[model samples]
Target chain A: MIAYRPREVIIEAESWKDPATAGILRNLPGIPRRTVADAGRISASRDTLILARYRGKFLKQCQGSGAEMCCNYFTASYAWNCHFECTYCVLQSYLSGSAIVICTNIEDFLEEIGRTLGRNPDRFFRIGTGELADSLALDPITGYSRRVVPFFASLPNGILELKTKSDQVANLEGLGHGGRTVVSWSMNSRRIRRSEEGGSSTLEERLAAADRCRRWGYRLGFHFDPIVHYDGWEEEYRDVVRQIFSVVDPGDVAWISLGALRFTPHLRERLIERHPGSRLPWGEFVPGHHGKLRYFRLVREEIYRKMNAWISDCAPGVEVYLCMESRLVWERSLGVAVRDAGHLSDRLDAAATGGA
Target chain B: MNITDMPIRDIDTANEECRISGELEAPALVRSLRDIGQLNPVVLLERGGRRIIVCGFRRIHAARTLGRESVPARVLGPADFSPLHPLEFALRDNLAFRPLEPLERARALDKLEEAGLLPETIVRVYLPLLGLPPRADILESQLLVARARPGLHHCLAGGILTQQSVEALARMPPESQDRFALLMERIRLSASLQRQVLGLLRDLAAGDGASWGAPLDGEEVGAILDDPSLSPAAKGEGLHEALYRRRHPRLTRARARFRERERALGLPGAIRLAAHPYFETADIRVEFSAPDAARFRFLAGELERAARGADLETLFEVDE
Candidate 1:
């Protein structure tokens, strides 16, 4: 994939004191640069990169709508959007003229994580930075992984996950992660990886990166999220599952998550208006909880059931969970009954904290 | 504004400098002028030694229809349009009595551009004054709606067609637009169903690689609408269902299979069983209404027997 280089960089004046700003300027040498008193006062496009000090809560609860069994996941949004224009991305609806904003206050974000862990020593938090933007897509330019990785290594209560689809693990090499950071990839079938996710890394590049991280002594994760179904989806996805287990040892993996394609009716309209040629969001959609559209429950179950069987066929006793599914689907497909959010959270916390 | 008696023959009716009205055929105004005469003065603009009707295209047409050679008129110089643009002047005059129709607003905006106002100024200043969101897309769609075929005028004005639907209908090939207008004339769809019908037709057409109106030309769809035994409402419903079934054959087949299984159970007429919403879930909904205790006991017994029946097990298999 071609690398993304911003045409212009607009930095907020308040971020001048932050060290990340200096690193960003040193990285993008000779690029056009302009400093504004407030990034929010100016309008920027996707071509422009705005660096501001995000004053909002850097650590927020994973907006997994409470209508379903949530995985007690927390999201830290150091950035606002991604570079790849996936056809089914929920951020497409959040298309404000304010382009991709990167918060330069990295120290403040790390301190917030530290304070939360210090406040609740008994609780194990599985915090991720990949909710709004890919965690490592901009790592080469931003060099955020070098700072965030070793910080989590010192904190014994929480584990950090930097999920991405790009094959940019060069920056992650030789970081003192101390087995506290889990580098995960958003996995998909080969056809979808080629057609829908147009600008990300290839299937080969992603698997090769996962193996590289696995050999580096970091726990790996694979999320077959938004697993699109088509005529030969079963065969293709089965091959993808087989390929993942072949490269890495099961013990080196953290967890595998499965989520079917889902969106809201509003996002469906926006997807059509923005990307008219993509038929990914149009299908047999039944209104799930919270007014979000999802695949027919039976279709979702069929997918999860087949996927779980395929994964179990390769490696037994691996921890696999559904991302935003109901309790009924969990029981029917994975044979794991989730009573509520806490039930699923405890199960995932064990996996993240290296328990049974 | 000063009123005067001006000869209608000298009025430059051909120069529609500010003709914001969509239709000039005013039957009620003509009838009123025939009975009680003109109550309002037609506003005219003086330009190049010619008089142009700025806000009274319909009034002038009505007076002409009544065979009145001269009529009461308010003649103004071009500078008199002032603080407000000529299009705004005409729009406010029309707005004083009733809301401007969709085509009128579109035409008025078009004329505002012609009246030396920037597109940005029209969007920022005039759009909100006209009760529209200050959006370029809304303006573009309204302009497309204004240029729709004359066959779609009554439907557009009668609220049968929304701005998006009009835009959709207008963007079709001229022949397809004619076919859809003819189809719309025969069957009336509800507000909720019109959007679904348009979408289903577009999807079916795209999937089949045919014209946008190709499905309406089919014999089966035509026969459903032309059925003499069906009421208009039933025709609309039948057309929607037929389009939905064709567009989603897998879902239709699954529902038909479920219906077949439901019929074979031989449950009482009062009891009803339905699959989960869109068959997305494993749970089913069963509801029965009973008036008396005896009737309730009978329904309970019937439900239990049917629940244990052999065909009932097959109903749970909702997959294709």
Candidate 2:
């Protein structure tokens, strides 16, 4: 993965007083810092970093369209935007600007999560920090996992899942996460990783990192998301599944997810403009619920069923789930469907915690 | 600049000084010239010992039609103006009266380029002045339309073929363009329909890795064109539907299966069931009309019974 080096840094007046902010600034010594007033003039040059104090509630539900079944996971947004440029990233259309933003108020974000978890002590919470940005991409510089991993370790019922495509797991090596942190990687076939996922870590690098995390007393997870379908996809994905099981023990693996490529209608034009030669947008699609364009139902079913079969063959008794798919699709592909979002959430919680 | 009266015969209208050629007479402008004398003087430049009218071709033509021997003119030496000044002046002067047709805009851009202006320069300077997007693709499309054959140019200029349609047509080979022109002339499709048909054709050709003329060679397309009983609108509708079905076979099959399931359910006329689009969700909407409470209860009971049938379950199945 490409390292993030902000050409310019903007700090809010309030955030400038925080010790974490000062440490971050001191780590990248000699980089200039500006106040929030200069935000309009900073030009958002793709390398600019804005460390503003986020005022909203940091812990929120993933914005899932009710048109499909949601995994019902909570998102802890400490950052926005990513350094790596995946051709089909949703942020290209969701974000209004291109600058990378990291909230310097880590204490306040943790306090909100602690309060929410304390209030619901009886219920298990599966919270993740990778919804809006790569969870561990900037951890080497910020050392945020040092703070967040221990925080979740102290929790009685909360699990923190640090998901990323980068192999930046060095900071997480010595953290006493008490089997609470599930270090996962967003993976795809080598063909897709080479063409679509520019500036991301290689598949072998990510699997090695996952093995290292497992050795460090952390449960491991894998997400085969945005699974692009192309010629010879069966062999491509089967090889990926085989490689995954060969490295890590199935007992240490918590959950594996499969999500086919899906995007909103407007992202098509943006993908074409940003990545001119991308063949991802030329697939036959139909307008799905919530105005998103999805592959034909048969294509999606075939991909999902084949992937589920391959994963099951490689690692028996490993729980495989579909991300943001419909009830009918779950039934047709995996032969099972949780009743609702809450049921799905419970199932994932049980899988992650090993039915504690 | 000197104001003089140059004879209509001496002003060389046949040279390459002006590339804009068409009906130069506007009846309203002619009537205005007759009611009140000429308001703007014609702009002329001296080149190769011949005076050429640069700005006011229409005004000069109007004067000639009025049987006037000479008209008021502003004369300039060739050194006083740059090569782009004539096209710039003509484009700017005519823009004030009315919007330029697509062909006219294309020709103006082409003429500017032919005068040694870079595409970037035209995109940055002239596109905004002519109310076009300042993008290289737009300039390329306009130049393509300008360089097409005269019949296609006429169609483009007359608003029969839209900008998008012409751009799609411009991507095809000349032979394909000729065939498409003949089809378009026979069908006389509206501009929006023309764009839709051409867009579908382009997608089909790209998906098949064949030429744009491949889809047009089908017997069904030819029969639609040859059928005398169908109206032009009907023919266009049939052709577009056929092309769409061919382009998206999976979606077409899914919809057909859904419709078949819908018909097999044998629901009442007052009730309707619509499957969720693309089967992205397993949702089925049941709509019905009831005039009174008794009828509403009856319809509700009928729906409750119909919902228990296996056919209704099949209707909501994901086929794609």
Highest TM-score: give the candidate number: 1
Error of 1 at A277 (Å): 2.6
Name the docking class for model 1: acceptable
| Per-residue accuracy of model 1 over A1-356 as CA lDDT, tens digit each | 54668899999999999999999888888889999897887777767888889888888788784846889898998987777877788877765763777899999999999998999999888899998888988888889999999999999878899999899888888989987899999999988888778789988888899999988888988999998866788999999999999888888878999999888888887776777666665565667866787877767888999999999898777789998888878988888778898888887777765673
Worst 10 residues of 2 chain A by lDDT: A37-46
Note the Cα lDDT for every prediction shown. 0.83, 0.82
What is residue A199's positional error in candidate 1, in angstroms? 2.5
Instruction: Supply candidate 1's per-residue lDDT for A77.
Output: 80
Question: What TM-score does prediction 1 earn?
Answer: 0.89
Query: Model 1 Cα displacement at A170 (Å)?
Result: 2.2
Residue B236's lDDT in candidate 2 = 83
